[model samples]
Target chain A: MTQNAAPPPKLILRFTIIGLVIAILATAFAYVGGWLDPGRLTPDRMINTLEDNAGVHEGYRRNHAKGYCVVGSFESNGNVDSLSRATVFETGRVSPLIGRLAIPGGDPHANDGMPPIRSFALQFQLPNDEQWRTAMNAMPVFPVSTPQAFWELLKASQPDSQSGKPDPAKMAAFFAGHPETKPFLAWAKTAQRSSSFVNVEYNSLDAFRFIDAGGTTHFVRWGLVPEAPFTPMTEAQKQDPDFLSRDLRERLDKGPQRWHLIVTVANPGDPTDDATLAWPADRRQIDAGIVTIDRAQDQADGPCRDINYDPLVLPDGIAGSDDPLLSARSAAYSESYNRRTREEAESATSSTQEPRS
Target chain B: MNPRTAGTFSLPARLLHWLMAIMILTMLFVGVGMVATVSERHVWLVQLHKPLGIAILALVIVRLLVRWRYGTPALPADLPPWQRAAAHLSHWALYALMLAMPLIGWTMLSAGGYPVTLFAGVTLPDLVSPSPTLYSALRFAHTWLALSLFALILLHLAAALYHALIRRDGVLASMTRSRKQP
Candidate 1:
């Protein structure tokens, strides 16, 4: 009688199976449409996509091409052990850090005063063969969540081949289909333009997991909170073509610039997968340590020039969350790294030939 | 029924009680610790926190089932009516918090466009659409719920201590001591 009475379990199981079938089919459809996974969006393809939007440079990265390298140290405050078991968090653990501060563009010679997003990337070497790497941007959130959407964003932003001008209709269509892009557009429209890279806060919008010694995990995103206040450029300061790089050089000459490494944790169920969604501002935060940049150099001759700063090269206690963008980034960075090196090789051969002639 | 012998709980009840006790305590500490840091460690703690919460949620379902199948022992005959009501209300509140907290967290993440990864390679389906406003409201609620759960846990612990140490009542033993043992 009881078995006959309760149909809910069987009903639920049937619906669960049906749901699974639908999900599998939907994923298959998205995959076939080339609108889900990043595997098809090869590094070369991504670079080419960016180049299509903005003409490419010969020997520079396809994006964030204009940059200056900095040598720095990350001083760990030892308050991190309870959250992650990484050696980078050991108190007083001083790690030599190399970073590049850059502005977003395909043009290596883009004017420094142009209003654009800034980027900061760091590689940290820890004891016991551990390493931590991250790439960050001044924007709080990226425009899209997936690699496919990123491609679409570039495509939409690209000038029509015939008209030689970006179509507003195409961008509007893209925004209509992908409403998530609206917040980013709103941010871009309203964001205060920072005058200098040192004063800008850079965020790792993708979420990551911090595993502690007891195997406890938390979802987190990090931001480099600049110690220098946001100093808007005067009209006179804006006239300098190399204002940012030049300002950083003069500032480093006087004293080391610093930023507090602030890591914000998502409460249980906080989004860890999407880069386009910014967590609520009041989420729990921790100022893990300080980053001090003592020296700056030209990107062409700098130690960081060859490094990819892949976010996936994580430490023992840290792991990338299921953020699809994280793996896409690693793939894209590798492509950028490889292409630049190959171009550098060709440029080197061409330069030597010129001297010989 | 003999009062002393009636103090024992069903074996499944006692086992689930102790297991859930440890899990809840660990989860509370882990939740607090997760909020306290933004270090590289916060990532792993987050990874650990999701699955642990889900496990607690899953176990609580079974626990509720077990509670229904094998009814709880009656309170001590001499216990005050108010005390008995408090005990009953607190137990249900803990169960509600345990169940609601994980579900709220899951829904919140769904709204925020984040996946609720149970652990490495396993992700649970999101329970809601991505909406920033909904995500914010849920996140705020999740924090307050956690704080509320924390307060209730302390009250429960204090009451348990009252029964075990001061009153010499066997109410605590109903869940703590196994029926199979002498």
Candidate 2:
């Protein structure tokens, strides 16, 4: 059966069949591949646009550009271990943590007392070799529900070159159209600026799922509730440019700052997908543990410098909820992290001098 | 046929072969998924991709040792020289692909200053310093190598099928079934 008897037409037919299949697969891949959605918002483009709007500060995080690192440990009281089988809750478990406290702005040297958003990002190393990383903001509620809306908010509030302020018309239209911003705006208008980062209650803003030993899934939002009393910053302190950083350093020098990790359990039909909505205050709150931050360090050489703090990095028994913004935020956080790290490396290479302490 | 050439593959050989087959297929899909989208799902996929690629790297080393020590069974005496040459070349190519893919992935991540965190506590030492230029180059290499590995797999499958079905040779059976011969 040497193919002298087999006609060339048969060979042609076989090639055509194979070619057809390849063409179809290539078309399918192109159609459903990464470029399928041509105008789809991409993480890189989102980050690039962010940098374009909020000018890049070399070696600094694009969003929370100004920050210092803190070292601490989270000691679980073992009460919530029954609710979730995570190792961090295994009775008296003291998991070491490194965290960053920051103001959410593009400028790293922005005034600390501008009534801007305060953020807390942390990484916990549990006994069982699993890690949990979370980033929380002091905002009572997120302004937008969807990631698209968040991007739109950034665009709408982009500062005018001449005035160095966002166009009032654009800002008004954005706020007027998005009713979800009402709660956040109302909170902002009357909210008291905290005396220090040690006293601010950092909220997760996104919901997450906690899986129990029994495999039951419970939706919850967790955050650090500072044990320090809610004292507003004095007018004189507000006038100081470095109040937040200075206050934290002075307070930590005396002793550790403490916060109770509170998990707010979601009730039946609670909104888990939208960060803009707040759950009822009466929802059962579980005091997961105590987070005592002892040492504050410059982010330049701190242990927390390298950590991405992506909110989706959860240990066993913990998982992300269906929040759309959570994914978008996590994606953007990585882009921010990558850019800053690369910039840091570049800066380190070009400079012959040791980095300033 | 030689009576004592070990017509069937040893249990260790068969187990590693099948295990690696499953792992490699999953690796391909995970690689695609991780790179395709910027959703939070990308995080999950990347986590899966890193450890799985390392596992393949570990097993491929063990597999090469096994190949050297035990060796593969001989092809049928009637098989063409071209098929025999192909069988020889494609095999080493597969092994080469397996070895290069993970090594490149690790190096690329290192170049990008990304940790190869297998678990919370387990991280592979970076093979290179954080260099964007190097990272971009290695990234392209890893992707093209993956596509080559994919094509090689399809070719390998076709050859195996031909031996199992068209030729009715025991080449495929030697790796699969425990029965040496009926």
Candidate 3:
């Protein structure tokens, strides 16, 4: 009878030891690598280091700097004399600014002139200030009024239910589910179809609070009216694809592209907490100062690409209202930025690996 | 004689296996790196992580199909039943995790109402709506699951080493592509 041969006890011992050693080594490595640590450092700090270090390497003072300064001055109805009548603070210098112009769509590379809203994020650094302030496409009101509505809107904007493209049905469902978005929808639809000329109008869809040196607070909606009137880009003009870029470039090449910053205050007695509601024209527009964009400059490749622009980066005087959208946006942007930079470093490492002989 | 470990894995299968191993390991490390970062620095990491997650997701699907079509070499007969079962179960879990992590991350990002950029400014749509509660829960889940995955990986490495150095059954040789015979 053929008997099964049993492995030697020594063999078993050896295997077990080997296994244990490997396990021990792996655990040690993991612990030293900080994998076992309860994520104390947090993702946001990592991103900030990446930006600051990268920014220095890129020859820029701040990672967000886009190489040009924008000074936005407010004017009251084209009347220089009326400027004094308004609460216009002459911001002598704003620096360390970052700007991103995006086509509003599910796809990042969606056509600039598509029938969708465009987003322009501007983050400016105030002198003698420690923080930054950001402005976006929508004015006082965000697309979603409440947290739940915001969630629904986000879900609706996801890739198509079937095709993985932006789903119109889903978008419609979102708007329908949150009727409060009706106001934003009206503006979104109009902005989507509107010509590039709309870019000239600085509309504040959100309401912000402006605190004075004396601790007095005023609810204000900020707007920008170009020295020139709105000139809608015709279909022919839009064909350039880089219509906005080209226009800005040309304007900058000639000289600084300047716009008047207008801040319309809420009625002194009646303060509006919600930015979604439009401020009455009778409230009177104040001349804040001019925002001028000088020649476009390029920073080091890294900073231009990796820096994040969170709207919550406000300075001392400009504090955020209890805008839930602003808070959500701040958190979301921080999370996303962290995730992306880590991936970049990994990919860069892998791509640069030397082949094992 | 047991019919397993008769020959090396096919070149294509071996290539895919190694490639996937490197990618997954990198992904795990990248994730750990991300969690370690502070929020101010996390922005850039988030931008790159999603695209890589999507890429890994795509690669995993392809790897699964390849494995199904071209079956992997069976375990050596010397491998105890428990070890064999453990290996199989661990591998399946890895596969499951490989898919789930990316999907969960994408969903989390979508729920946060942020566009997923693959790379080079290529933005994808949000997969879900932004909900603080949902995001908080998912973020917690993602972190915990990742820790569990790292543990499983350690076990896997241990098993492989056992077969290679202790059992001397050629398991590691099969994966390592050494010229040494069992």
Q: Per-prediction RMSD in angstroms?
A: 19.3, 5.6, 18.0
Off by over 4 Å in 2: A1-13, A20-33, A353-357, B1-26, B43-94, B100-182
lDDT of 1 by residue, A158-198 (tens): 98988976798998999999988877888998787677889
**Candidate 3: which stretches are off by over 4 Å?**
A1-96, A138-141, A161-165, A189-199, A237-240, A268-273, A297-304, A347-357, B1-182
Candidate 3 Cα lDDT to native: 0.55
Tens-place lDDT per residue, model 3, A104-124, is 432322345653444445555
Query: lDDT per residue, candidate 3, B1-182, as tens digits?
Result: 22235456655667777887777666676676545543333334455567778888988898788788877766776666888889899999988988898988887666543445464224555667654335545666787887787778777877777665555566776766743454
Residue-by-residue lDDT tens digits, candidate 1, B1-182: 11332657778878888898889767766665444332333345566788999999999999999889988888777666898899899989999999999899899767654545564435677688654446546767887898788778767866765565445557777777767656
Tell me the TM-score of each prediction against the true structure. Answer: 0.58, 0.78, 0.48
Residues A1-357, candidate 2, lDDT per residue (tens digit)? 222222233455555555565556445544433556666666766777677667878777777877899999999999788878778878899999989999887777888887457899989886443678899999879998987778788888787889987899999999999999999999888888888999989999999998889889999999899988989888999789889989999999899999999989999999999899999999999998899999999987777766677887777788788998877877787677766766665666778653221
Model 3: chain B TM-score relative to the native chain B: 0.86
The alpha-carbon deviation from the true structure for residue A142 of candidate 1, after best TM-score superposition, in angstroms, is 1.2
Can you write out model 2's per-residue Cα lDDT over B42-61, one digit (the tens) per residue?
Answer: 66777788899999999999
